[model samples]
Target: MKDRPAFGDPSRLTTGAKLFLILSAALLPLALIAIFATLQTSRVADEEARARLRVAADESARSIAIELIGDMVALRVALNALGADAADAPSCARVQGVFAQQAVDGTRFAVLDRSGRVLCGANFALPVALPSDQPIAAAVVPGKGLILAISGKRNGPTARAFFPQPFLATLGTPTSRSSGFSSAIVVRDQELVLDTIDNAGPLDRMETTSADIGIGDLALRASVRSAPVTSSLIVAMLLPLLMWAAAAGIGWFVVDRLLIRPLRQLRASVAAYTPGELIDPGQVRALPAQEIRELGDTFRAISRTVALHEAGLAEGLVRQTKLTREVHHRVKNNLQVISSLINFHARAAPSADAIAAYASIQRRVDALAVVHRNHFAEMEENRGLNLRAVIGELSSNIRATAPEGASSVSIALDVDPFLVTQDVAVAVAFLVTESMELAMSCDPSAQIRVAIKPSEIEKRAVLRVVSRAFVESEELRMLISSRYGRVMEGLSRQLRSPLHHDPLVGAYEIAVAVLGRD
Candidate 1:
């Protein structure tokens, strides 16, 4: 006896399994692409996040340093008013008033002798020792404040300023502290941290960065915890794919209801159907969708008018054409809807960066649409796409659809006439679009030159994009290097070749396969 088929056999799949499998197969390529793109760009994203944190720390330190300088300048001016002669010192009441006006909140002023004794203006006890022969010294005493001592005339008199914990905590800008940044002021000579300002909540990992305060032996150090890389990568990779899955689920539901279910029912009826017997009108009326119902009625009519054997062949061909047309129409409609929604949101976006991001997404959608349209049109002929025409049209569309600032860019293409498969066309279009955008972003009026020449290898071509803006401005190059590096790498991978860069000449080159002439 013959062995029975296993559970995994295609013939054994139920309707739902078959439908689900078809959807999964359709989405497999897209899911793989999303994963690859995320993997390629993950390092860049992490680096950018850390770079932002460092910049925030540096800025916070600088702002506090400025405030410290203001306070020190006020102390010097007040001491000058007191006069260098110790015998003719101002009255304690007058001295207290001067100190009170000059001192900020959470701070105290005191006068001490060379023996570390309080002379005058000692309303509060000193937390740190008096200065030695050195002009100035700073020390941090726990639970009190930072003490800055200014020596006067060989231990005769010393002026000391006490910056308490509460006062020092409020030195930096409020923005950084609110966004999970904590900072502390340190006296380097004594290796002591005077005060810490920690307004941040729980964090994953605290990374500390330091900046000089520009005062004697003082430094400002800021710390912040970065978001978890694993969680970020997972979300980045899955979010769009989840959205795609939802859309696919809806499409599957529609197909099953309108087409698949009815076809399955019709198929059963046909299996039970006799050669001379007419199709059952009750089952025909029970079918969903007017198209399927009409299809059933046509099948019944054909069976009545023509020979049964020829009718069966004709019905199968017509059914296939109808199903293909219907599915294609739905897909095209869905894509158009997606494009319209992107346009609506892009226009309503609040910032230039958001609008530019939306534009970038829209361009990718357009690129896919272009490739699909060309592939569908050429399906009957089996001839490969015209690379020159596709690139020319794509270049014009990209230039016309560029974000507001890049409209004036000049993209000159020197593509030779060549035939290329759909895959090669897609990679080329994206590579060219990415290169031009890099040039345009650096300088709106930047001239971009694209040249595609036949390679020494038959059925292959080398593409080169040249722009002065890439090499002329260091700031622009640095800004786009990490951002575009992964994107260019992914495109080159699709072309099955490495992307070569000529920084001196501001040019990029890659080799890609083309269709050979018959």
Candidate 2:
């Protein structure tokens, strides 16, 4: 026999469950790959944003450095021109015109003597001390701005330029607002020239780009805040999730329609089928899958084959029942004919003994005829004769056929209802006839009684015959011991029990136990 699925075994999974599992197994790796790709893409995007910010900061620093170097060079040339002319008024006005022409907004230039005294400039102050060897230097004055001091020569003269802090704010790239990076420019060893700290709000970390302005003393540091996560990054991260959900939905639809639904329909069809009923091939062919359709076809073929065999078996059973009934009918008719012939022979017998013998043979033949008649009657219904009915008929017949002188030998029957096979009923009928004949032969006026009842403990049926006028006659004993001994033995063998006899106080009793149908 084929092995059955255990409880909770995966092999017993329904079509839809199996389909869902298969789709899930197939999509799992693809989903993982999509998620991984989205994450990597987001990372790359953040890195690009940071790289752009760095590039912008670096470019701004280079531009600022070039501008600062140009300013310092112009300052040195102006200082040299002023030194060549004199510290007179006309030469001073000419130097002022040069400074005015070269200066941009938030820029201030001043000429200072070797004593560090400001002379021909705006927004400059005399310093308490000056560096002897430093060619350029910067300072952050409180509440003022950034100040750059450029020496004309070693301690000869110096030019000072003051740039307000707001000028440094313009150095950031235009994309800073969208990129979430704040820009700042700071002078080395001094205070911040420009700071976006207030505008930037909070800073996680700082990224800086620095450049030396080539004026030997000034360096510009361009700084910006790190890039924050943007909406594009969020969209990138969520894209894979959306794709996976959509793919799962689509997979469910496709697999359920093309595979699961059809298989479910096929399962329902097969479950609904009953034995001996026709299976429709059209319904089976409606499945979309080729292999499943073929399977349906195979099932249809098998069902058809089974139906054909059932039809043949039913026809054969009908013919056999009819043939059996006809055979029993013929046997009963032939036995009756033989009984009639014996009765006729008895009527024409030469002597009293011959007539008695013929009568006895006629009665026995009539008992057999009765058995066959009951068998024929039950054959059409596929059952046995009712035991009560058979016993009643047999007793009546035997008493009617008794000799003229034994007409007073009345038989009483108290038999229970029993259903037995044809062979058992026939054997029982013969046994009853023999017992009745013996009782009548013993005494013409004998009171004979036959009874059959079920034995509860032994699980069998018991038939008993009792006669009150038993004489213990020698002829009766000889008949039992010699002529009828084999007949009684055969009936005993049929009943699967011994024939028992008892002679007791004015009564002779005989009983046999037979296996019951129930």
State every prediction's TM-score relative to the real structure.
0.37, 0.64
CA lDDT of every candidate: 0.72, 0.70
Q: In candidate 2, residue 65 scores what lDDT?
A: 70
- Inter-residue clash pairs, candidate 1: none
Best by lDDT: 1
Candidate 2 TM-score, true structure as reference:
0.64
**Tens digits of per-residue lDDT for model 2, 200-268:** 555354555565545545555555554445677667667766676677778777778878888888888
**Residue 87 of model 1, lDDT score:** 41
> 482 in model 1: Cα distance from truth in Å?
2.8
